[model samples]
Target: MGYDIMKNNNTKRLAVSLLLIFPLLVFGQKRVEAKADRLFQKRAYALAADEYEDLLKHNWNTAYAHKQLAFCYFETREFDKALPHLQEVLGNDDLPLRYIWEYALLLKAEGKIEESEKWLAYSKMIKLKNPLIPRLSQDSTWHPVALLERQEYKVEPVSFNSKYSDFGARIYNDTLYFTSSRKTPENNSNYSWYDEPYLDLYYIPLSSLDQTPKALEGGIRSKYHESSPTFFKDYKGKNSVFFTRNNLKSGQYVVGKKRINNLKIYKGEQKKNGTWDMSRDLAINSPDYSNAHPF
Candidate 1:
């Protein structure tokens, strides 16, 4: 599953993916900037990067353009390309704290450990909530050791996978539950960010591997995404189910022009007949941020 969700207005910091190409019209620089901004808003990082690069070539360079270009490359996993653009603007006071953290990560990815640690330390001074800071600090004095032996392992693909994205598998009792973005005849809506079908939970009995996977019933599967299913015994010793779903309030997940549908954790109680009654959203869920992968 995609780890980071982008927030609206370019204010909140997050991680990346996906890109597209756009044409450079014979127009003004401001028009190009506007088009780039629109593409970024639509989560088309590739096209946005192209537009921003065009703007820079025409001597319309600015901190915003460089920052957006860096983000576009970062989202596309072109860390080598993103590093220079991030460096171009990191010295600017107007740059957000999140980009500083990203700069440190880019350095680490490029094997510049000492430089990465320095930037990570500076980022921690700003009090940003990055998991890498503590981890790098703890492992600062650690060194790699040579291994004298190798372990043999066998790898094979599961036969029950479709062409679309299928992952996040978890086993509970005799059932194997997982998340998939495969399209079905009954539902064909695609998420604009990846142009893939929204995720849904599906399960197959472990004892009956030949049988086709079935979508969960009882309103557990919705039009939007429903993924990362987890099973546990509740405090009262009742069977409990926890999963991640888009923030829903008035039967709609997207709101206004931003198209925000932050993920939240949901809980379901097992009924006498074995069907789950998932009618409550846990208090730990937040409408503004995502809380996923409940174990």
Candidate 2:
């Protein structure tokens, strides 16, 4: 009936609880901070979570309790408990923007994609009404890459997406190319780690973003994976593409002596009919290690 996060198979939490109580004995507890805050500061999150939950039960400083409890659950990776408590904490206007980032990530983990993206976008707004640091440097001179972390940027979801995963977007010659794990007819394999479809390169026209992305085929697509594509508009009068793929031996995914298969780099040139022919394998690729994301 309580927030004892340590699993039933563990005895370490009992020892931690004893150790946590000794400090409260030595310090002569006077308030909730003396119990939960001290445990939180000591990084005893599993124990602190219980005390904060008790505070919630008693209706004492509920917001503070929610804040500490949410963090306690978060630190312990108890996201199911953390989400509701964190939602309460977000009501405070003074919450650090970092928590907003955390909430978005949690939402994404819960598969609430659109809401997660919305908060992710909202995180860039000015949280501080009056910032003290002046951003200008060297008599109003500025470089695009200078102090980029200090700059504000907005986030938005691209129209082309999968409920699975899609990222590593790059724009070349008015087309957007990226890696996606969405199922396609040619891509029948699955990456076992996440149980999702194997990745493949996909592209969409920048002119009509609302349309579904077209999967790149020919030698550029593979039965295993094709990702992180870099394009050259004119390589000897034909467009070229460089990408990463699983090591293939005689049209089968190759496994090394150690039973490890690694990604290798391949380059190809576009044909006059817009199909691609597999060119040469990059010499830099090694059978022992992975080579990916060629520029």
Candidate 3:
């Protein structure tokens, strides 16, 4: 009887200890979550990702937290890290169509072709939050992919690619120009959305493909993105290049009605010494929207 009394006393002590700690655990979780939410609202995605990841590592799994984590990773372009969190929130009835579209694209990007197709089909069956996305996707693809099979050229990966965003390639006059976000010590300005440097134009002469690609020799590289280069002749029959850059006003970053810095086409006349003139945002550009890819 005495031993049983002691055993019951020990159980009571353990329960009392848990009761004392439970509120602290709850408070800690709340504090972390609040910090993460504030950072997310401020659009500090990388910092929010760190906080949410810490919360999850401690096993505080909530659909809201998981969804937020996914958004944080997605915004920071950390798609591989985002995929698991995205999968966690897949069952949420109120989930947006963009996340579903992202999951489909992420799966496809990771080589899970069948799984991506399945999610895409499932996205169709559900009550889509953005039904117009499907229509837009279809409408946007027709012109780009229509001649895919007709083209007989073998695609080759360029040698100068860094483990960063490299795209919007065009070849003109035996030089291949493309946009890249590759890191360089002299270039420190970064895109506001993430940690990487802003995109800049680079070129590799076809005759010297084995050599390191050089930055476009001019004062054309901006603190913002400079992309999509195409060489052509101006109305005056002078050599010129068209490129896409952010809508800057008075040398300051300007956000449009959507609170986003939109891209616009800029024409630069090639001077006798190969340097470009100051930016001339084309007449076709409107500050309210993005206008790019001048062919």
Give per-residue CA lDDT, model 3, range 1-295, as digits (tens).
9999999999999999999999999999999999988878767788788888888888775777899988988788788888998899999898988788777767666656577678877887885646554653443333222233234578878677888888888887798888889988756666545667888888888899889877776656667788888888878988788888888876688887877678888887777896666557788888789998877
After superposition, the stretches of candidate 2 with alpha carbons farther than 4 Å from their true spots are 1-152, 233-235
> Candidate 2, overall lDDT?
0.72
TM-score leaderboard ranking = 3, 1, 2
> How many backbone clashes does every candidate have?
0, 0, 0
Displacement of the residue 58 alpha carbon in candidate 3, Å = 5.1
State, as a TM-score between 0 and 1, how close model 2 is to the true structure. 0.50
Question: lDDT per prediction?
Answer: 0.75, 0.72, 0.78
TM-scores of the models, in the order given? 0.59, 0.50, 0.72
Put down candidate 1 lDDT per residue, 1-295, tens digits, no spaces. Answer: 1333333423332212111112233347779899989988878676788889988887785677889988888776567788889999988866787688678766665567788788878777767766756875555322111011112456456777887778889998889989998888744888654556889888899998777788776666678888898998888988888999888765577443346557889997777777676768988777767888897
lDDT of model 2 at position 134: 28
What lDDT score is found at residue 146 in candidate 3?
20
